[model samples]
Target: MSALMLDPASGSSVGLLVAGLIVLVGAVVQGSIGYGLNLLAGPLLALIDPALVPVPVLMIACVQAALAVVREHKHTEWRGVGWAMVGRLPGNVLGVLAVASLPLAQFNIVIGVSVLVCVGLSMLSLKLSPTRPGLVVAGAASGAFGTASSIGGPPIALLYQHSTGPVVRATLGAYFLLASISSVVTLLIAGQVRVEHLSAAAVLLPFMLAGFAASGPLRKFLRGPRLRYAVLGVAAASAMFLILRNLF
Candidate 1:
């Protein structure tokens, strides 16, 4: 195991350790505030190893979403999630095609810029009600982005930013639970899911669980406006990171 954990930065046996710590922190954020594991972990993990993006991080996200759903089951908004998923199916198909055919570097730049622009719009009081149509649009966007980059929570999170904490967490959790399944299936069909992806996820699972365990104590401090700001801040920073990494 030590031989396998070579650090890309220090050339020490701590690459997996660093990745696990990142996952742990991201998981705590996601568990406490709902929706940030991918945004926080995806780019950093990609720096550690490009192959770790989208699939392995997504697998962990699926688990996190599932755990969130179980923890917040009573607050789940089925109607909104249903409509979003209705749009997600087709969007997921399109995303798979994009991943298969498009140039990843260009797509990364486009996605990064798009996320930053959306985050900026959100900060400017761009709010969307969680109506059926709005949910469908958000869901479709989430499916496309998630399938391509594994960072799909921002759109849905933005849509529900003004909602109560439990609702936001529960709805997004349920939505991600379903969406992650769709993404994995699509990736499997696109020949993207491999044993190594599962292996990486396994390696990171303990840290994810640990972070989630820690979140139980931190949830009290991150309510209402605090939660909203945390989501937006993380989203903006993650988008900026993606843009800089791709462009430079």
Candidate 2:
């Protein structure tokens, strides 16, 4: 891979503030439901600059993963997590390779399509429980897409949703934590990691944390059908936006 590079800075204090607010909100969604930050960040930051947006989302995934591992560590399904990691690690490498070969527009299109597919399947109630092959498939897809598009959660989220509540949360959290780390490493190796991106992510970390903290009380207020409908709505809207952007 080539050396990592950043564009001449395309953001200002104002841009940063706006992006940070979105990241915070995304984090709250994730903290409350165990996923959605990337789905949230994608459209919000896409309005800024698509190239720069994925970096912050990826970085924030790392932070969220760390937090998740801490919160759900005791319940993590180590076997599933380990198996999924095997698939995800290699899939991430493949995704980076794919990105390296593609033009920017093509890359964006690929990511958009993948995200839309994930959302569509999710809306249809196809939850994936982690069996041997299931773990592998979900892991590979999540890793590849997470690095390429910052939309890795859907595949794993769908997978974990079939499990019991704690199991679902623990497995999804562990998978994301692992996948997020792998994505950051892959980006570094592929020369996509950038100083400005890292700086932006660092500045926004506290906001993400605050968002996560903010969700604790909200969870009680939003339960069962209400929460499902809200999250599904967000996911569907996100998918539609991605498809529209790709087509336009």
Candidate 3:
């Protein structure tokens, strides 16, 4: 975890600029298509410090999830959301514990592999419907990855990919909101939720809100195929980046 901590010196103006760009762009994509911020931000931030990756990313996720759920409240699938919460909460506790003891590099490797494998299966036509078992699995996986790397959307996204627009957005928004809430609790229990970091996340909140505002027009214009392809491309690249980083 120490290896993942942010270096104060590395938080230069240029680094902050780059991080801000990531937040802006990632937030737009997330706001437009229902998710992608951490997928895009985590690996990019990892280049600065892997230890630093989880907290800021989680912070942003907290904000993103809240906004998303607020925006898409009407279409949420109550059954799936309820079961997902049940499975995720305990798993999040386990994952937070892992964060204290597990190496970031190793966790990255595992999460990277999991993302690649899940995405590949989706690409291979293995449908991940939001059934009871699938929801449970996705929830548990989301909880673990959310705690471990602040990148919890892939498993849940895979499930929602084939769903209708409203269903997908509502399902994902709800899942993320709940999982993030649980992850925050776990982080607090683990004493990893720092006040300073929360302050930093607060400062970035406006950027996320701005991005969401900017995305409103674009969301109506973008079709499903275009959005999915864009998301898949980014997610695949991030997964590969994680794998290669671990390998070297």
Candidate 4:
């Protein structure tokens, strides 16, 4: 059993610890700006262990999203969330099928490139509103990519790019809370989620919560355009990193 399980003092455990710290940083960014846990940490964690990619990251995201939703419940826009979910279900199913049957490397490459393109478009000042149609389309795309890559925040984040910081954080938080649930369920049904994934998430949960707690003081400093720019920069960098990591 000792050999089978990760020993805390071992190199593998150190890697896990490093991964946890990365998660902590990602959580801070998510708590401050509302959607970055997966984007920031997903790629790094995947490099540490492929099993840590989507499932474990999604589990941690569920916790982070739920906490964000609770902290900013009053700002949630249920109507928009409803519309996004309408499209998310089908997209999620398509994503799950892709994960089950398709070549994941090629699929990930496609997603990475697509996200980079979308982030580029967003940076060009093309305004995407959180309207019903926009939300549906963004939600579907988010579901598809998120289910596959665990990097779902970009689509919805770009849509609400021009909104106020609080609205962006709260609405994205709410959407992520729901979207994480759907992704987890789909992954479970598809036999992708396992006990080890849950174990890894459990080990990393404290770091996530700690980072979130630390972000409370930092959030006040990142309001207005500063917040918007920060979100865009992080999203763009993460997308680019995903593309580069997959290609090489």
| Overall lDDT per candidate, in order of appearance | 0.84, 0.71, 0.74, 0.84
lDDT of 1: 0.84
- Tens digits of per-residue lDDT, candidate 3, 102-198, equal 8877987888888888878878878677788888888888888878877887777777776655666667777787787788778877888765566
Which regions of candidate 2 fall more than 4 Å away from where they truly are? 1-11, 103-127, 221-233
User: What pairs collide in candidate 2?
Assistant: 128-159
Residues 150-190, candidate 4: write the lDDT tens digits: 98888888888777777778888889989989999998988
lDDT tens per residue, model 2, 1-248: 12112222543667677777888898888877678888888666767656555676788778886786687678788898888888899889877877778664566566666656765676676654668797788788877777777777766665555454445555667778778878888888888877777766777788889998897676555555555555556656666666677677
What value of lDDT does candidate 3 attain over all alpha carbons?
Answer: 0.74
Instruction: Quote the RMSD, in angstroms, for model 2.
Output: 3.7
* Residue 186 lDDT, candidate 2, scale 0-100: 84
Query: What does candidate 4 score on TM?
Result: 0.93
Q: Candidate 1 — which pairs collide?
A: none
Best candidate per TM-score, number? 4
Clash pairs detected, candidate 3: 4-50, 4-51, 4-52, 5-51
lDDT of 2 at 65: 69
Model 1 TM-score is 0.92
Off by over 4 Å in 1: 1-12
